[model samples]
Target: MPLSFYGLLEASLLMLNGIAVLNRERFLKKVFSFSSLSHIKFQLIFTRFFSVPLIAINILVILFKLLVG
Candidate 1:
């Protein structure tokens, strides 16, 4: 298996898939049904904090893995 392969996989999956799913209002609504308004707001904020950095880091990791071998 690749070094930090699970890390790479997780970051890429969240970067590619989670962003799209969370970005849609309908999906988010369905996900957090019955939750407080504040909680939903927090999730929106957290998503940005979580997913945005993964793209850059994942790219660097992939490049580093390729170059080091």
Candidate 2:
């Protein structure tokens, strides 16, 4: 598998784990609905953090493949 695949998988697992732990608090769930809008917010934050670098890496991979193959 590619390095980025591992990175994505790791990040996803970590995010889920964090959500699970964060939602363990009843008050948190009541206030933030840890399973709802906050999830979307987290995804938005994560996408902003990861998408650009991920796209750049994929583009470089494609260029490398094209040059070598």
Q: Summarize candidate 2's per-residue lDDT along 1-61 as a digit string, tens digits.
A: 4679756865665665455445334545466555677777865686677667666665766
Q: Which stretches of candidate 1 lie over 4 Å from their true place?
A: 1-34
Q: Distance (Å) between predicted and true CA of 54, model 1?
A: 0.9
Q: Write the per-residue lDDT of candidate 1 for residues 1-69, one digit (tens) a residue.
A: 556976677666666655555555666667666567786687768678866766676686678779986
Candidates' C-alpha lDDT: 0.67, 0.62
Per-residue lDDT value at 58 in model 2: 58
Q: Please, what is the TM-score per model?
A: 0.46, 0.46
Off by over 4 Å in 2: 1-34
Candidate RMSDs in order? 4.1, 9.0
Local lDDT at 6 for model 2? 57
What is candidate 2's local distance difference test score? 0.62
